[model samples]
Target: MSPYHHGDLRRAILTAALDVIATDGPSALSLRDLARRAGVSHAAPAHHFRDRTGLLTAIAAEGHGLLAEELAGTTDLRDAGARYVRFARQHPAHFQVMFTPNLLHTDDLELTTARALSGAALTDALAPTAPTGDDPHARYARLAVWSLAHGFATLLLGHNLDRLLGDEDPEEVLRELPMFLLPPA
Candidate 1:
């Protein structure tokens, strides 16, 4: 196979990588396979990603940044949670890798940068609901919000709850969960 020019090879590999991850799951992602799909020589991805972990790390980083920006754009804090849910639903591949820490290369500079952006965005979104009292209260608020959103998404993605509830439009049930989060009249 021909090697791609350096300029576009990296992007092309990453794009192909995302597609592969989406359709085949992270465990099946192989740079050699990705390069084949990208139409570059097998070694081309190494020039950009160094190795399989490097490529996955980059994908994880990009996923984090995308989720961070999407969550940060919400007009309401509640909406931020909705956006998080929606992003996972829409980009299941990206969302899956973004949260799976073992797949991320902690030493990678770009990965660190992306993780920080994601952390900052989440912290900012949680700021409004932060407990008005001591550290414990603040911790609880943050944990509560995160757990609520994350648990919902995890259940929805894995079809655990859907199976339990027996397939009555999961989103509709999720939409109603937010109402419980609302302050009662």
Candidate 2:
């Protein structure tokens, strides 16, 4: 075994990648730069990740796992939806990479498994409102819920709604979303 593999090299590389992305966005990611920040040899990150795609796939997978944990905490779809938005805001770098399939190794087992776990958590939260059997409304309901949260998060991330939001906290605004968007309980 390579002596460079000694302590948590993979985790350190991944953490450095996330810090770089959080500061400079995904396009700024470079294994050499990350390795330097991680205090590892330039080849060390490559040894663990193979390439940028491999590293990004791991990041995206980890993002999905975190998202699953966030969504799983809420019993109600509305709260789950709010947590979805919060997760995006809290982990913008991960959020950006997780949804961009072209940037990830889409066929990787870890990525797909993590993605599925996140999807299942969201689906399960919405299951109570989802119509059973051959109805397409259930699928549409899921789409609508996801769309609402994603669109809101995207807009917030881009600061596109700052004029509309003015002085109010974004999280507070998001918490009010269910009052207007969700069906009466």
Candidate 3:
């Protein structure tokens, strides 16, 4: 590979890594394989990502950024929840790594910042529906919103809900579920 490829190596490595993860799952990912796919020297990926944890951490950070965009400026909880599922479906590889903290450098500053941004967006989006005060209802609503969105995203990504969902689109099912579970405002 040309040394000139270094200018684009970071993006190339991330794209290749995402492809590998999407095709064979995260366990199959290797810096050597990513370097090969990116047509760079084996050491090139390491230059950008010190190791696999570093690489996964970068991917997770990107995932959170995308998630924040999806959840931003939402006026409804169901809308935000649906956007969360959409983000997961659209970027399954990133989604998988984003939630699996053990596979990433959780202490990485960029990853932590991205995660906090996404969390803040979700909190803001849910604030309208969340009841005020220290009541169990407020706590339950907050927990339920996160659990329902994350659980559905996890299930959809794993195909664990296929038998339960039948021919229906999973996103549609998710959008409808919160409506029934949460009190309408």
Task: For residue 12, give model 3's deviation from the true position in Å.
Answer: 0.4
TM-score for all models, in order of appearance:
0.84, 0.91, 0.90
* Candidate 3 TM-score over all chains jointly: 0.90
Question: How well does model 1 score by local distance difference test?
Answer: 0.75
For each predicted model, how many residue pairs clash, with residues at least 3 apart or on different chains? 0, 0, 0
| Best candidate (score: lDDT) | 3
Which model, 1 or 3, shows the larger lDDT? 3
How accurate locally, in lDDT, is each candidate? 0.75, 0.85, 0.86
- lDDT, candidate 3, 1-185, per-residue tens: 76446668999989998998998988999999888777778888887899988999999999999999989998688778888899999999999999898998999999999999998898787788787667888778767888899998998888898899999977677767735545553
- All candidates in order of TM-score, best leading: 2, 3, 1
What's the lDDT of the predicted structure labeled candidate 2? 0.85
Candidate 2 residues lying further than 4 Å off, grouped into runs, are: 1-6, 178-181
- Show the colliding residue pairs in model 2: none
User: Root-mean-square deviation of each candidate, in angstroms?
Assistant: 2.8, 2.4, 2.1
Kindly list the per-residue Cα lDDT of model 2 for residues 1-185, writing each as its tens digit: 34385488899889989988888888899998888877778888877898999999999999999999999857666677778889998999899899999998999999999999999898887877777545788788778888888888889888898899999877567667754436543
Tens digit of per-residue lDDT, candidate 1, span 1-185: 67855458878888887888778888998888888887788887888898888888888888888888887755545666667777778777788788787887887888888888877776677666565545887767666766777788777787777666685655445545644442321
Which ten-residue region of model 1 has the weakest summed lDDT? 176-185
- Cα lDDT over the full model 3: 0.86
